[model samples]
Target chain A: MGGDFHWVATEPSGAGRDILPADAVLFGNGRQALYAVLMEGRRRFGWRVCHLPAYICQSVVQAARAADMECRYYRALPAADESPDWPPFQSRHEVLLSANVLGFSGLDLVPPDWPNENRIEDHTHDPWSRAACESRAGYCLVSLRKTLPTPDGGAAWSPLGLPCPSPEALIPGHAAAGQEKLAAMLLKRHYLSGMAVEKEEFRAWQIQSEAAMSIQPTSRPLPVTASMLPHLPWRRWRVERARNAEYLTDRLLGSLTAPALEPDRREVLPPPTPRRFPEQCPFAVVLLCRNRRERDRLREALIQRRVYPPIFWPLPEEAARRHPEAADFAARMLALPCDFRYTPEDLEEAAEVIREFFQTEAG
Target chain B: MGGDFHWVATEPSGAGRDILPADAVLFGNGRQALYAVLMEGRRRFGWRVCHLPAYICQSVVQAARAADMECRYYRALPAADESPDWPPFQSRHEVLLSANVLGFSGLDLVPPDWPNENRIEDHTHDPWSRAACESRAGYCLVSLRKTLPTPDGGAAWSPLGLPCPSPEALIPGHAAAGQEKLAAMLLKRHYLSGMAVEKEEFRAWQIQSEAAMSIQPTSRPLPVTASMLPHLPWRRWRVERARNAEYLTDRLLGSLTAPALEPDRREVLPPPTPRRFPEQCPFAVVLLCRNRRERDRLREALIQRRVYPPIFWPLPEEAARRHPEAADFAARMLALPCDFRYTPEDLEEAAEVIREFFQTEAG
Candidate 1:
């Protein structure tokens, strides 16, 4: 449970600048924010087609589909040390949605010539990263719940000083769901503190919260999230996450075999360091195995050692069919827990498990 | 804040029978439960028109409207000691939805000859009453959150062992909203215990929760609510409520003016007794003012004394036009809080405030 990437209540410290932009519109969750942004584009510019990365979370894909946008898949995840191959686009009618994937790298992903008016950048993985702050996309969004201890929060902002779609008053059901998640986060803190709390207790609330969020696609952020945002220690979290991710990457560097990835798929990218990128935080320490079989074997071994890592995503069927290389990347990728939850010592223990797996168990 | 009827976390004690029937389906809130039932009726029995009480909460009206049911107004309150006059029905196609208002008296409301298949009894005001338990209606529903400290809960059951409509999994937004309410309840307990908590802190959450519940008309109850229900001391709460209500009624009996009422308009019903009706609990101590002006005056006076009793409802514009007697009753009736939150001593202080308002302040 200590190594599992579950939510826990983080104590608030000194006040900082608001995590989100002043003009950003808030929503109950990221999918709602994305859907609202897409619908706004359709309303304002008659946008119909949405170009998305095939190697992405299903939630992004679902948001586009829910907006009734025609989706076109594009390949992401370039080979080692190469830039992503940016595709040519027509006009504002065809919107592009790209994510700052894992917050590891993003500087080269944005094509300078791409129309900012037709782009939406997602920084859900790491909103504190430089990529998010410097994004030139028409719209930028972040799912704050992913990074912060808040139960529900999604913010969509216009980086180009354009108007963003504002959500109406939150529906009570959505607010209630958010509150449930908040309770879960608090319960998790108790569980983590060695209290007589069942792991399933928080997990059940979390699962229910997710189901409720999926049902209500659009709503304003809960009042608690709004009030709690400024109080969250974002800078500390950023540096801590960076240290953890970097420590894990360093520990695994020699032990992990260089994955024989396909031409379009990349080997793992080392996490950003706090020294190089003070504001940036890696979403996780990315680990890529030689194949899907090896990835699963390693994942199971890590789980046995109580170091639970998550697959970034399993590709959707259509995405898998359309972009085989992205699908291949998905099969091999495992995101180790590298957020502010653990210290370098904890990562060292995790590193020992990983070394044991690769040196003694993995083929 | 001491006299205010806000939520507080109640400590769970010994296990009792589940508050809801085993076969009953749960929902995020009362409106959702009612809406789902109406929709189910439409799907099964081709039920079109729904007859509702003229004197009712807006939530009940909205639920019917959301379900697209044709609503008909029925006279619910009768002269003192007289029964509610049941109107002629047109088979099961014209469904009747009636509430056992305040749970003070309900045995006389049901027309013995009416078809049980067409009746939907709302026991939200007091679900544990003998009237609710012994009802011959086809369906009976209660909004548990109204009585229990849980954030959100609505249960629709059948007295005749008939099948009921089942709610789908809770939407994450709604579940989150409920969780928010739950958090508010816990915070409220701290506030009540003389902690330095701002009143606005919990009120904001409660307001947000209500908004979310309104937006989502249907979903299964949050798992927290389901788990918390059995542990709640319903029997003790019921007894305490009865005691508080009875003591308040005993004190206010002579101070209250028996209004020169119309034959259609009834005098206030005294709180039910624990000795005579062990399972029954009065929703509140009902007081009928001489007029709207006097009612408003007394309400303000109580607020000055830090007692915040809510108006059961204000008549909808259309309902006011259709039922003058019910509209007048809504304007004049005040429900004094008599829940488990207050002791007899607390009620005595509230009673003193009420008596002073009538004795010296009244015109």
Candidate 2:
């Protein structure tokens, strides 16, 4: 076996002494984890209706669908106080999904009157949030791939310490997935190094490998992935990500109106403010464009400089019909990478590129 | 990029020109396929109650549980005519799992009056049975790995041309599972080729790899696995298996009890005749001991000689309660491999080994 052949994945554990007990299971992806709790809840409590935010990953909907539950949604927007603004809904027996987008928000958004046992936090983008992991909701869920180098890992655990099936039972499925990802990781390393190779073909192959994992909805995380969980420099990475997000926000403050930087409280008209996700070890530095055209233009400019910023989603037709705000967010939002891999200088260069794009537009 | 590195999986296609229409989707295992159809049926038709044979793989129950449906099983006994004797209960909206075990039985057992639209055939063990592929059930599902060397693959298709999602979408999950399998395959090859490896250590690692695949359910067959689909010598395997079964049955007629060679219409107390399963590619050659004690003794004897014939299962408590016959089968039934890989002489050696043990016991 070569040194760079198979990658070490994130170990399945809590920050300190809290090993995600046997009751808290880790799976191949976030959706699978979400599916697990929904299925468990449905089987024991006859919960057939699943309630989640309109502004969430498509996988969340897919998870509910897989669990054979009726999906209903309510608003999940950042309020003026920068807390999650969960809209009121009449859900008696529905399983509610309380999600934290970009890691910082939504944990505080549960409607106080709803049964706490019904809420499952979709902390897919907020794996390291102390509040997310420590929450007293019936279940706390997180996806590791978004914040870590693991090929695939999603976790769901009982906050109440209920007895749950051990994820070890799902390992056969993880091993299957691990085979393809290991090859891709090796191929990626080879490509990233000075070795000459066909880049696009390799990339397409890697994408194909990744696509295969999504279809395996109920598998467990690989042992190699589970091994590195405790070793991750969580606090440092979290701090660096927060620092990077703050830095980018301060630089892009007046130049590009970021709603996340500080919510506008009122308008849906002019360019939306950059919504700042404070205190969270974010998946990316998110920015909102005035319109799709402006977003596309900035995206193109960034691409030319070899800086790739991904859009939140393309928006499914059903989702678009259900939440127009989500559709708008999909059209105009851009996510800049700020994971543990980047340095302050690298982020500075990326921010400068964004500044140049607007300055050129004004000229 | 070693030549013997990764085994190319079968290129997915329906048998012959049918290529399993676009409506047919493949997955990582048979349970995943079962889970898929169950979830789809529950979501689309308000099908919440699931009915399946008590005599089945543990994964079938696991899959049903994962789908969050109410599972109610019925007793299934091999009919006097060698077909499945399915007990009748009034079911209007319930989804029925019509399954084929040992690739020879059950398909013929479907009640003529039962709604075909409500039936989903678990043909994981019966891929080569022509009648099974031609069944009129709403969905026909199979796991390719049981019949093929591909590390992980499961397929579910609508024989009725129901609209289904493209399996290509699940490739990422498959790729993730593939990497672990490829590594294990490499290790297996190395171990087999006189590499002087630690046998148990390698086996544990391989087991870990397989465990990962079970976790990553709902994934597509790998492209490599799909590529080899057409090339698999299905006919040859079926013929070799049939011939081997007949030969063993002819030789061991009064000396042993084989449920799948040529069924004895009358006595279970007498020396058992071979029950025929001609024209089907079987997972193994079935043998039943007179009692659990004899089974244990024979199993140990076979192990001492390195001719390992595996017990069907060590029955689960719930399964044992629901289907005592299945539990009995599990305790006494043993399956001997008769795959394409075995040569005539190799099979003869295995058959002779069993013959010698029984002859000594009788003496």
Candidate 1: list runs displaced more than 4 Å. A1-17, A42-49, A65-70, A78-80, A89-93, A169-218, A254-268, A271-274, A304-307, A343-349, B2-149, B152-296, B301-307, B310-363
lDDT per residue for candidate 2 within A20-58, as digits (tens), equals: 434567787777788778878887777888888887878
Task: After the best TM-score superposition of candidate 2, give how far the Cα of residue B348 lies from its true spot, in angstroms.
Answer: 43
Candidate 1 per-residue C-alpha lDDT over B1-363 given as tens digits, one digit per residue, 9 for 90 to 100: 233234433234434356776777888888888888888889888889998888788889889888898988877762345456567886778888888787755576576667887889999988888888888888899888777777788989888776688777767667666766767765565456444457787888778767777625477776656655666778888888887877787887745543432313323456333354565567887777778997898889988988877777798787898988889878888888888888778888887897777667534
Q: How many residue pairs clash in each candidate?
A: 31, 89
Runs in model 2 lying further than 4 Å from the true structure: A1-23, A78-92, A163-168, A171-174, A214-217, A257-279, B1-178, B181-363
DockQ list for all candidates: 0.12, 0.08
Considering every candidate listed, which one attains the maximal DockQ?
1
Task: Please give fnat for model 1.
Answer: 0.21
Candidate 2: lDDT of A243? 68
lDDT tens string, model 2, B37-114?
877887777778788777777778788888887887776643224445454545656788877776646346475666
Best by lDDT: 1
